[model samples]
Target: MVIRISKGSILILCLVLTNCKDSNKKLKETTVVSNIEKTLNFNLESAIADCQTQLERAVPKLTDLTKHPRFIEKEDTDWHQVPNDKLMWTSGFYPGILWYAYDVTGDNKWKKEAIKRTEVFEDFKNITEHHDIGFMMFPAYGNGFKIGDKKEYKDILLTSANSLATRFNPNVGTIKSWSNKMHPRWKQHITIIDNMLNLELLFWSAKNGGNPVHYDMAVKHAETTMNNHFREDLTSWHVIEYDSINGKVLNRHTKQGFADDSRWSRGQAWGVYGYTMVYKETKDKKFLDFAKKLADKYISLLPEDMIPAWDFDVQSDPKEEKDASAAAVVASALIDLSSFVESKEEQVKYLNAGIKMLNSLSSKKYSGVGKSDAFLLHSTGAKSLGWEIDVALIYADYYYIEALSRLKKLEKK
Candidate 1:
């Protein structure tokens, strides 16, 4: 067939060809970027060694082992240690970091320091006014037992789990995260998403010869939080208030996010970590499914660097500050979650996502290294409360080291 094309039609064909060429270039560029991300080198041993060096410098500065180091403010050169008499929720993290260091290096000196720091929380097992006994004891005594299998450490962990159980009201179906005195505005029995992490102690203790009731309480709390603490999209609220008498959700709010409905980065991390752990302990498919949903939502919303801002819904500004602590928690949790998933595809995706996060954390941009004694930098702790913004938090260091240790074990396997 002989056909004559008009000038306009010829122009249209040329434009279409140009657009196709542009699209092909973009596709090639994207593929290269994806390949680069997949092949990014993450030296787990070097990262752990860097952490050990940081800890070696930090331990000497902590002259009083009784007072745990908490954070280093952006403007300060020294750490703000938790007061000796005060029962801080973060008291166990310092010891936990030491324990992880010992695990990674198998150095007797790290073990000795870890034991000294772990013993400081032995009396914390009896603290019953709050739900943080898990935070205070598990990382200290729980890790101690896990490493050395000491009878004393096991006993302390059991006692700590029991104390945590006392805060669980049968009527509320969740443990009280804060006492009335702790937050006067939260007169109703308040439970924070962070409470999910404390359930691990109960689950472990129940399996290790404590009251089986501890297991039931942990499951009940997980179920209640699973039902009430999450939005339809699966992002979590930092706090949920409940009616103490009848087990009803009274209000959903946030203490550390941009607003009441905003997704706090650390709170979501807690959900991912907590649900993953709950599924591991219970072997319930429902919990595992919920954990995947939580992790998926979190992974979906992370920034390009794999680190998240303090609040996911916060105004998008380059200087808005990132939460390395949240990244660390999610990294550790994702590594554990990777093992639980049945599909190999899902396993590799989660595991690679976790390693990518750890790689970002290990970089000099987020790593404390020579800048501070803490292991990681730029962690936001309760930014809405104007506290610990852009600081190196003890918990961030704890989880970073924990993630590294977990990754090391996976490499061996």
Candidate 2:
């Protein structure tokens, strides 16, 4: 070894060593990328772990909220503020989380809590004519059925579906947005794309409960929404007009957007996810095509970190008030849509985009360490409604898990 020799030989040896080091570095980088891809592909074990930790921390807070129950009066965190009695709708979302918690940890405590929480709503009929019955009912009861195979949960879901069906106005071709009890004169009005989320439960109800009318009505509402709610750019409006008595398009309005003409961020997200879900259920090419188009528009506008501003078209400097919930919703729905795409490239595009958004969220800013709340991050509510700057909302948590579940399922397959 000591006989080494000329400078040329030494130079050659140095070059080889450097080359090997460079190759190793490159290999490490590639491995990191692969791990990220695996994370995106959906690892249920990890997702379940994250979900359980969040749930365990959040449950005590929920239990505290119900110490005294009343309509929209039950005390909750600042962001998730709703009446105790009316908050029963949110109770639906919790069981699914609880179920997830139970499923992941095999914890009897989670199972008991889920069952007890669901039992509270066993006779809890009388759904308010809000735009989120699906959120209210499906998470609480629909998921409850999935978790435990309870007939009562199934029955309540069907009943809620029936109530939702009644809210449908044949004239508007959409479900009336809200019950007039909150506003005497607006007895039957069509507004909000949020209802589209709830309509899927109606489809489920029809299929599971033998009511074709419910499925038909859900499709009608979805069709009505796609035609009227979406703007040319695939942006969406929060309010629209429908001849409630005749099911005809009256006009498009913007009650919730920044202006009657501005594109609201959450509303756009609602449209993207809703139509995508509709496409999944109905296999309607129009809906799927529209979903892809809107998704493209949405992804194009995303900020550097992938979280969207509360309103995409808002001219003000980007605000942290941006909705993380929207990203979660879109990601979860995109995963669902991925299965329907025949092209592997197309599937990867949608799924990868979603994974990027979720990973960005899980990083420092969106999901802080020891946050203790079940929420992932980013939720904003109407200031006039006294819910501005709400964080870690229930819906955000729900969809975040949903996205996680979809990703995890893909990995297994």
Candidate 3:
């Protein structure tokens, strides 16, 4: 006898098979994601050891405390030193790296070297020709005071904040980033996104016994930058020229990006890190929201490895250089920003992004082990000017160590 099946039974059988296939596909996707996360789980202790080894190699090569490593040229084994006497903006990062090493390893030698290197910048407080005094002083003295609680470091930081405040034009509501003579085309008061990082010194000083005007200056500068420096998409312009007398934006342009309409990777990183720091100091929700927007935009533009090109809009050539310094800076900032957000989803997203970037930097592909004296390699600085491209930068090492230290602390929490 032939058994007859209803059309309804056949439809039910088909639906069950379809459901099983969908479930299998989802299970495979989840397994892939789990494998990626596990692979990206970095070894913090080993990463820190690599940094210590690099620092050990670097210290013996420092012939003068006044001369600090800025960047290494391509195929060069030795770091090119720049004199602190010139008040170079990159000076503090070397001492800051030493301080980070000291923090991570509890090594007295790194502390001694950090103090020695940092003391060279004591005279920089009096040089207020530009707005980079914070960058020159904070990493050395700010981290020094935080770690050692030295009164001298606090006094130096306060003095440096005062000098930075002098560059803030009340009318323009922002700090002048460069001197007119330096950029004759920008005849008016000009501010760059990098200036946002300098405001942290002012915010810290105001809370730690400096004048309240420093705080006000920082807030105003951040507000003005938030208003004028960002496009609708939250990508930042490298420079904003303002009429010093009228407090009006005169021009929105680029100094280091591919074009005036393009986004500079380091500049965008500065905005992300700076706004996160500003929110931390002020506890303002607006700054925090703005920082999240900046961070999301930056993260969305990154390649699969979580590293960005020197500029986002540069023609996508196979040889396009990556900015590990920018990645390091944003990684450190994202870790800090992760802790500040209230949403668990957002916190996990940011923390995971930070970790992924750190993992990429710590891998053999980026680590400077046995190849250079720096902790990481392939950082681009001002590619438009044929400056330091795909080389080791001191700030990259500083922030990479900072991010690792932060992750270690966060793990404990």
Candidate 4:
């Protein structure tokens, strides 16, 4: 306006204009950062795209060379086919992976591959010796039934539940994990944290009109596990031997972990996933509360990377390897667990923990999705104590896909 004004007034007006310009720039910069945070939070679409790419690379190698997907990438990345009749604990996961690939990509190639791999498990549905029927059938037949609702898939799952039910010892109040004769030192019965996983089969059977005994068996097994398999801190033991005559807990031990008193990461994952499953099937508050307790204990012990060592008790050893598969399993379970919690803070805590793990798993450090024949690598299975160490395991691949698939669904909703 060029009106007459004092010198000090002119300087003050210039200072005010400069401050306004600085404030606008700061606001714009903050807005850009906020947008970046939103974009980077969890991109489900990009994750799914990465999965499709990973599967396209990984699945063909599995199907082209092997009649059954064995998953221990051998010489020349040849699909090392394991005998389907061996009844390995992870036999079902291969087919499950195929099913998931089919689910996410809607590719008939993956579906046909899944079906071909699943057909071999026809014999698995009738075998009753072990407690991995859920692991063996659900990922294959359960997803088969889910994707198509085929009567055959339903029938196989039902029959497998019956076979699994027969292993439940009424005298011991839990499903026999393995033959008592195999581990006769217990002299009664043996159950494991792994057994909790098998209860999903029983629950599904009971809910789907198979048998009430299946349901009863599941409840009893879960109750037994909740009482004996867990310690005061909610960390689980791998196995619990019981007195066959009186159902008394004979001893608690660890078969696949660092020590008897140590926390096996996968075993804890099994417990968390199984109990959350029980709650899902029964809507039981006790199971939900127990799952939350276990989740809290697990989250508290997570290393800086948010991944767990093969055993929580391996703190004494700097050479201890991280169980990325266990982390994947727990991450998958936590996504589901978050939905059951009534508290918002608890829900956010669980969900963020899962998202952090999924992010870590997808990073270059842990995700060797395309580098080798395996879809996901850096998984430490059974550590150096067992045959497989720092290798890509079929279960690890299965659960990694599963966790991604789960988060994608949640994001869509």
Q: Give me the overall lDDT of model 4.
A: 0.78
Single out the weakest 10-residue window by summed lDDT for candidate 1: 29-38
Instruction: State TM-scores per candidate.
Output: 0.90, 0.81, 0.90, 0.86
The candidate with the higher lDDT, 3 or 4, is 3
lDDT of each: 0.87, 0.68, 0.88, 0.78
Best by lDDT: 3
lDDT of 4 at 287: 91
Q: Judged by lDDT relative to the true structure, which candidate is superior, 1 or 3?
A: 3
lDDT tens readout by residue for model 4, 4-48: 899999999999999999987656544432333264475555666
Residue 221, model 4, lDDT: 88
lDDT of 3 by residue, 132-214 (tens): 88888889999999875566788888888988988989999999999999889899999999999999999998999999989
lDDT-sorted candidate list, best first? 3, 1, 4, 2
Give candidate 1's TM-score. 0.90
Q: Which residue segments of model 4 deviate by more than 4 Å?
A: 1-41, 64-67, 70-79, 181-185
Q: List the residue pairs that clash in candidate 1.
A: none
